[model samples]
Target: MTNNTPRVALVTGGSGGIGRTVVERLARDGMAVGVHYAGNKARAEETVAAVQALGGRAVAVSGDVADEHAMSDAFDTVEREFGGLDVVVNTAGIMLLSPIATLDLDDLDRMHRTNIRGTFVVSQQAARRVRRGGAIINFSTSVTRLQFPAYGAYAASKGAVEAMTLILARELRGKDITVNAVAPGPTATELFLDGKDQAAIDTLAKAAPLERLGTPEDVAESVAFLAGPARWVNGQVLYTNGGVA
Candidate 1:
């Protein structure tokens, strides 16, 4: 509220691939950033260090995004350290592939807890704290539309996110906060490609119209636009797939 800088923002899952890229881009854009992580202390710290190295203000805060109290504390830390809140980018998600018939309840629950519940907790917190003209950006995936085999659970989880974002934007009608979701195509992160053979990866590459995997940075740019300048784009799901689906 005192400088040319717009406002502070928080990026959940800040230690992971897409999340880390989002934190860096937002920080570079002159917003104080809170990098939230779950159990990846070293990586989160490294993310903070990298942002600092780039002359950006940032800090790492650890908490499970699914827990209400923990998410509350995360925002408390962000407001306390960075002055106040303005934007939120939720990139925390888990993807476990399994046939619906063979899917373990435990795996299903974990994905829901982190991807669906986590998104709710964090978005709720953002709704309460972010200032007027602030933004809330949630992560979805192009997989929901692609409907690839063995990705039912993952797609379902992101589907929940898309639903949440749509309603939250309508619910916040008079508040000046724009809520939206970004669904990226297959990205070249360890999490996205782990355990896949070269042949499998090559097949996936061919599936995309671009004939390659997406990079975390590619997705981050979309996030940056939603959080910074795309104020009118509320209550929409922007799928950043290379015309795949």
Candidate 2:
């Protein structure tokens, strides 16, 4: 956090919809970025290329977010490449929806492995490695509050994330590191749009006071604030849902 040296950020799931925007936003904030992808090497590379196109420094690192060793290596790569780590953003997640009465336990387990365990793994590394003045941002969802049917499993996982974010922030006290979660509502991303009918999307969009789906850029702005100047905003969930409770 010195004056001359630039900050470094590693964004997990950086190849996807919101993750890609987070990468670009952090890079635009003058932080060298590590774009982490799970399986999409080409998309990850394209993100890196886009960052480079903007004349920003970036590298692509791949790993399963739930794998401890892979994430450790990823942290190492980002730190080694950029000289140090200042921000870690966990954006890699999966959502499979079903009513709790008939939900597949297999689906629940799979989603938990990625959303819950994945946040923990990445967070453990960030807690251990991120420099002072750093921030760790995890993704949650406003559905935890809205309690929409069929999102029980997803909400449960993100509820765990909100809990972890507060606990991690308290644990990092005096370290000057902030831990928080960004819970976005009805963002217009492939993940949210996939398999959703137009009526369903419109209903959710109008549920917010903004009366429209949130753009990835809208969420990225919240992230950029947390990563840069929101020093006092710790151990909290900032709902980037356009006033949707």
Candidate 3:
């Protein structure tokens, strides 16, 4: 028998960018949401309020994705506030771009700490706490396949996400949970636009066969599918790029 209760979701880094759009899309799909943010409490609250303004249920929860205790508490808050978790979208990550040769070790370490370790930590909690028939969607980047020059460290971190995501799907064989990763190409978000001049932006916009940069809404559509339906699409790294790779 199908359950009548509304599914709930916890989106890490949901305060901004793709994460924010993901939260909005999930809420529109009739799920209560926990918007998790690392540092910006106010920003997360804004996302929650926006959802509420649209007659959706949402709550802002804060935590550093890399901190086990913190993430555990965030999950606890979501389960407690929303009744239970039906989906987890680990969108919390950092990107520091530089050619491999001159890349700062500290930057690499910081990026990995959030992008790799953070994904693992969040996925672990989702595995333990998310109810059966739920979904776990992790974020990846097309740069792993695109082989962009300065994205070595960033792509390495995402490559790890892809590997663990596939293994985690198999590991949860009997749980009725689907684990997948969404790898998006360049999207038109504030975070992606930051520091990029118009020329560079234009160049990337034309890189895809679509001849334009992707919008957050474009990426969120794929996430909404993985979170709610598309049950047969499991253990895969879905390249949500518009033919960029």
Candidate 4:
């Protein structure tokens, strides 16, 4: 409301690798941020501390992203603490890999529960609450275009995310809010590097023309652009994959 009030943001899954970087980057952008974590209270607080170390304002909020009521409370906390919300980045998601034939139905369901339903729940609240001139950013994956084997189920879930993200952008027309999704490819994170040998990692690393796996900080820069300065960049899926696709 005042010229001096900093912008506010709520980043789901803010304790994870890429999400953690996003939280700090937004804080660096001068936004008072609400770091939302599903179960890792300690890690979330660590992220809060990192932002504080940077001389930024931050708070850690907890909730399952798929739970409507809990996420509602999380959003309320951000607004209450920071005065108003200007950006919401839904980085909360899970990836389960398998060929469509051998894929466990339960695995597909679990991934869908978190990735699809979770995004909807968070985006619903964001649609209702983010102040005018705010932005909503969602996470998808470049695998949808990469068509990599064993990623069928995961890609399907993210495919739905891409669909919903574009539609939400249009639905928010005239509200001065921008809705978009960032699709990262071959990022080097603990979860990503797990179960892979160095040779395999090197092969995938070179798959991109950039000749290296993407880093969380690399992905965070894209988020920072959308959250702060990319006002006209709405309803687009940014493939932050170093031209792998």
Candidate 5:
């Protein structure tokens, strides 16, 4: 199921702050992109339009990342539309913060379902369907290393992602596909800045040795490397933070 065709990439959460940047970057890299969105059809359409405006090929696909059948269909659509599947970037995730002692079990379950189970589902499809020479990039967080006080559950979910990423790379032995995770620290995305006050933001901004928060494009660069040229860098987590750890 391999051919010398133009590279194709499917990016989950392609309408998101970081994911949108990744989609555009890959398009600029000359790959046809399938922008997968969980629910935000309008934003996904906007993303597709942005790519098309740039004279790139793109389509918007909708599916829940945690649903095996939905993701399976999403993959099929991308392969059908783009002629083949090459790179898959799973950036669809949710973060819910809570201290361990007072954590709501329901919140934990919801986060795990999206962050852990959703990643597994998407990775499963990527492993089975991505063409040879393809790449599978998953998202983790620097919070796992920072171990922030209220991030216990969120960190646990990403820990599972880190584990699966390494193991899946080994499982795909003999295939030319690369599997890796990108861990971004305090990136300046709506998801990270939504509820934080100026004081909190300032404190976090100074935490990194570079003395500033990272942008979505900063993380997207790491993803771009793994997806295209970083063939030798596999089964590892690349932290895109400014030496925060």
Candidate 6:
């Protein structure tokens, strides 16, 4: 079900790696995108500019996905400017890797706030507000299936996302709104490469079946599929991991 009437889409963390790709792709697909960011106005504006350069409508909105007030405000901005929402992509998340025994409670709490609570808060709003045939997409990570050593905390949080997505789909069974998540493996994003060295990066890059790390555009392709068309798919956690886990 392709749309040309300019559907509105809100992509949280729109300035980030996969988020930016999702924003750009949805915009190109004829959706008026909401480039949402927590504190990066310049980057968000750049995403919006790129979308505009592609002959699409986009606007940058600021909000904390964990905060209801902020999320509602961002949604209001989208509705006011583009009319109403048809798609919402919850892509705002944080990853702090540490052995479970060495994990900091503060870091764990912070990750939980953004990855779990934030996804829930924004999804709740999407459940109530998205148009009849809209899509509510969430973000997860492939580490949940890989069971990587230092990723326990992050994976735990995304596990919550996996569970919430399935239940949310059942809860919204009559609404025609599909709730789903895309879990990508190691991607070539700043967030995914923050502390790695050259050799380390090369080793990790070749760990996947495809012999290279995933790309933001690769993950965005799965998200875009679930967001538009793919109406029969719901509550699925599609792992776009290059067959790595």
* Clash numbers, per candidate: 0, 0, 0, 0, 0, 0
Candidate 5 per-residue lDDT over residues 146-198, each given as its tens digit? 99999999999999999999999999999999999999999989888998999
Report the poorest 10 consecutive residues by lDDT, candidate 3: 1-10
What is the lDDT of every predicted structure here? 0.91, 0.94, 0.94, 0.94, 0.95, 0.92
Clashing pairs in 2: none
Q: What does each candidate score in C-alpha RMSD?
A: 1.2, 0.8, 1.0, 0.9, 1.3, 1.5
Candidate 2 per-residue C-alpha lDDT over 1-245 given as tens digits, one digit per residue, 9 for 90 to 100 = 68678999999999979999999999998999999999999999999999999999999999999999999999999989999999999999999899999999999999999999999999999999999999999999999999989999999999999999899999998999999999998889887788889999989889888799899999999999999999999999999999988
Model 2, C-alpha of 31: deviation from truth (Å): 0.8
Q: Write the per-residue lDDT of candidate 1 for residues 158-226, one digit (tens) a residue.
A: 999999999999999899999999999888998878899999999888887789888888899999999
After superposing candidate 1 on the true structure, give the runs of residues whose Cα lies further than 4 Å from its correct spot.
Answer: 1-3
Q: Residue 4 deviation, candidate 1, in Å?
A: 2.2
Per-residue lDDT of 8 in model 1: 95
Off by over 4 Å in 3: none
Greater lDDT among 2 and 6 belongs to 2
Give the local distance difference test score of model 6. 0.92
Error of 3 at 148 (Å): 0.6
**Over 4 Å off in model 5, which ranges?**
1-4
Worst 10 residues of 2 by lDDT: 187-196
Tens-digit lDDT track of model 6 for 75-183: 9999999989999999999998899999999999999999999999999999989998899999999999989899999999999999999999999988889999999
Please state the error at residue 5 of candidate 4 in Å. Answer: 2.9
Instruction: State every prediction's TM-score relative to the real structure.
Output: 0.97, 0.98, 0.98, 0.98, 0.97, 0.96
